[model samples]
Target chain A: MTYCIGMRIDRGLVFMSDTRTSAGVDNFATSKKMFTWCTPGERVVTIMTAGNLATTQAMISLLEERSKSQEERDPSILRQSTMFQVARLVGSTLKEVIADSSPNGQTSDDQFSASVIVGGQIGEGRPTVYLVYPQGNFIEITDDTPFFQIGETKYGKPILVRTYDKEMSFEEAIKLLLVSFDSTVKSNLSVGLPFDLMVYETDSFDTSRQKRIEQDDPVYQSISTGWGDALRDAFQLLPSYSV
Target chain B: MTYCIGMRIDRGLVFMSDTRTSAGVDNFATSKKMFTWCTPGERVVTIMTAGNLATTQAMISLLEERSKSQEERDPSILRQSTMFQVARLVGSTLKEVIADSSPNGQTSDDQFSASVIVGGQIGEGRPTVYLVYPQGNFIEITDDTPFFQIGETKYGKPILVRTYDKEMSFEEAIKLLLVSFDSTVKSNLSVGLPFDLMVYETDSFDTSRQKRIEQDDPVYQSISTGWGDALRDAFQLLPSYSV
Candidate 1:
C-alpha cells in the first residue's frame, strides 16, 4: 500500500508520497513513487502513484521511454498540449499496462488496479492536479475540493480538511502535508517514511523546489514529536465528560 | 453507516457510538446503536451495533424478549455465566437474525450482516470487550490492541492510537473518545452528532456515567473547535520544507 497527496492551492501545486511497498508482512521494500517530467523554462509535471506497484512502474517506464524520443509516441506527456491531455495519457497508459499484464481473461480488477495523481503546468496552460482512476478516467481537483488523496487517506484526512487554504505559502503547505503524513504513519503500517515532496509555484515552469524527507531527519522528528505532544495537550484542555 | 468504539482500560471499559443512520445521502435518520442490560450488583452488559440496522434491531429485540422468560430461550445473554459466553450468545443471535431476515435462502452476506462490540462483567469474570463478527465468532481486545472500532473508523483512529493509556482517567478517556468522534463527524456524513457515550469502571455492575452529546452541546462544541485550533497552531510551529 501507498499514500500520496496532491493539492492545488492559489500559490501552486504540492505533491507528496510515501515510498513503502509491501507484498505482505514479510516482504517489504523502499521504492520511489513520485516521478517528474520537466523542461527548465517550459513545463513541469509530477506524477504520484498508489496501488499495484507493477502497473504503476510499468506505466511510468512507458512514459519515460516515450518522452525521450520526439517521434516515438504521438501522445507522450512531453508532447501533450495541456495538463488535461497529460492526465488522459497517463490514465490510458495505466489501463493498457494492466490489460497486458493479466493472462487470458483471468485478471481480478482489484489485483491490477492503480491510481495516479498528475499535476503540473505546460507553457502558459493553467496549473492543476488530477486523480486518474484505474478505469482510464480522471477528475480534476476544483475549488470546492482542492486536494486529492489516495491510499490510506482517511487516517490523515481530518487535519487536511480543517487546515487546507488556497492562499497558504509553499512552506506552510509542506508543513501541513507532513503533519497529515505523520498522522497516517503513526496509525498505519502500510505507509512508512522517506516521503518525496515537491512544490511547484503556479507560473514557475521548472522543477527547482523538492525534498526527500528521510527516516531520521531532525525537522521531521521534531514535527512528529511536537504534534503528538500537542494532541495530548489539546486532549487535556478539552472540557471533560461528566455524569 | 455508523461509528462505534469500545476500549478496555485498566480503570474501566469505555464505549462511544454515533446515532446517525443513512440508506443514502438523501435518506438519513437518527437511530440508537447502544444498548445495555444490567443487574445492578450482579452482571452488566453493553452492546453496540454497526452494519445492517434491521439485523441489529431484530437481534436486540429477540434478546430482550428471551431475557424476560429464561425457559423460552436456550442461549440468552442473561443466562450466560461468563463474558465469553455472553459474547458467543450475542454473535450467534446476530447470525440467527441475519439468516431469518433473508428469504429464499438467497442472501447477500454483505446486505444483512452486522457486527457488535460487547463489553461487561459477569459474576467475578474480568471486565473486557469483545468484537463479535457476523459469522458468530468474536475476538477479545487485549492490552496491545486495547480497542475495537466499527464503521468509519480510520479518520478517528490516529488520536486514539496516540493518546490511549491503560491508566488514564475516565475524563481523559471520554475526552479522547469525543475527539475521535469529532474527527469522524467532520469528515463523514454517515456518522453524525448526538453521540452516545458510557464508561464502566472495573467490576462495577452499574451504568452511572453516560451522556448523549448533541449537536450544539457546549462542551462538545468547545472540544471540536479547540482541537481544530490546536492542529492549526501545531502546523504553524512545524519547521517548513525548503528547496
Candidate 2:
C-alpha cells in the first residue's frame, strides 16, 4: 500500500508521497512515486501514483518514453497551456498503460487500476491540484476542500479537515502536511519513509522548494514528539466523570 | 455507518460508539449501539454492535428477551461463569439471530452481517475484551493489539495507534478515545455526534463512569479546539525545506 497527499492553497501546492511498496509481509521494497515533468519556463507537472506497483511503474515508464519522443507526448503536459489539460494527459496515459498491460478482451476495469495526484502550474493562472481516479476521470480541489489524499488517507484526514485553510501561507501548509503524514506513518506499517515532499509556490511555475523527508530527520522527530505530548496534555485537561 | 471503539486497559475497559445510522445520506436516524447487562455485584457485560442495524438490534432484542424470562435468564450473560463464556454466548446468539433473519438458501454474503465487542468481568478474573465476528467466533485483545474498533475505524485509527498504551491510566484512555472519536467525526460524515462513552475500572464490577458527549458539549469543545491548535503548532515546528 501507499499514502499520497496533495494540497492547493493560496500560496501554491504541496505534494507528498511515501516510498514503501510491499507485495506481502515478506517481500518489501522501496519505489519513488513522485515524478516530475518540467520544461523549465514552459510548465511544471508533478505526478504521484498509488496502487499496484507494476501498473503505476508501467504508466510512469510510458509517460517518460512519450516525453522523450516529441510526437507521442499528447496534448503534452509539458506543452499544455492549462493545468486541466495536464490532468487529462496524465489520466489518458494511465488508462492507456493499463489497457496495454492486460490480456486481450479484458476491459479497462479488470486490467488497470491506479490513481494519481497531479499538481503544478502552467502560464499565469493559480496552481491546481487534481485527484485522478482509476477510470480516467478527475476532480479539482476547491476552496472548501483545499486538499486531496489517496492511499491510507483516513488516518491523516482529521488534521486536514479541521485545520486546512485555502489562504494559509506556504510554510503553514507544508507544516500541516508533515503532521498529517506523521499521523499516517504512525498508524500504518505499509506506508514508510523517506518521503517525497514538494512545495510549489504560487506563480513560480517551478518546484523551487522540494525535499525528501527521512525517518530520522530532526523536523519529523519534533513533529511526532510534540504532537504526542500535546495530545497527552490535552487529554489530561478534559474533565473526567465522577460517578 | 457507525464508529465504535473498545479499549482494554489495566484500569478496566473503555467503550464508545456513535449513534448515527443511515441507509443513505437521505435516510439518517439515531439509534443506540451500546448495551449493558449487569447483575450488580455478580457480573457486568457490555456489548457494542456495528454493521446491519436490523441484525444487531434483533440479536440484542433476542438476548434481552431471553434474559427477562425466568428459566433462560439464569444461564445467559447474567449467569455465565467466565468472560469467555459470555463472549461465546454473544457470538452464538449473533449467529442464531442472523440465521433466523435471512433464510440459509437465499442469504447473500453480507445479508445479516454483525460484529460485536464484548468485555467485562465475572467471578474473580481480570477484565477481558473479545471481538466477536459474524461467524460466531471471536479473538481476544492481546497485549500487542489492545484495542478493537468496528465500523468506520480507519478514520480514527491514527490517534489510537499513536497514543494507546497497555498501562495507560483510565483517565488517559478516555481522553485518547475522545480525540480518536473527534478525528473520526471530522473525517467521515456517516459517523456523527452524541457519542456514547462508558468506562469501567478493574475489579469495580460496575459502570463507574459513563457519559453521552453531545455536539456542543463543553469538554468536547475543548478537545476539538485544543487538538486542532496542537496539531498546527506541531506542524509549524517542523524544519522548512531549502528553496
By DockQ, the best candidate is 1
Report how far off residue A2 is in candidate 1 (Å): 0.9
TM-score per model for chain B alone?
A: 0.93, 0.93
Reference-based lDDT, each prediction = 0.89, 0.81
Off by over 4 Å in 1: A66-75, A101-109, B66-75, B100-109
Best by lDDT: 1
lDDT of 1 at A212: 94
C-alpha lDDT (0 to 100) for residue A30 of candidate 2 = 87
Worst 10-residue lDDT window for candidate 2 chain A reads A234-243
Q: Let me know the DockQ for model 1.
A: 0.72
Per-residue CA lDDT of model 2 for B58-176, tens digit only, reads 88887777547666555356767899998999999998878777755324466678899998888698888899999899999888889999999887888787778878777677778
Clashing pairs in 1: none
DockQ of every candidate: 0.72, 0.49
Per-residue CA lDDT of candidate 2, range A32-113, in tens? 9999877667678889999878889877877676446676555345667888988887888877777777777336446357
Distance (Å) between predicted and true CA of B62, model 2?
2.9
Residue-level lDDT tens digits of model 1 in A25-84:
799999999999897788999999998898899999898875456666543678898899
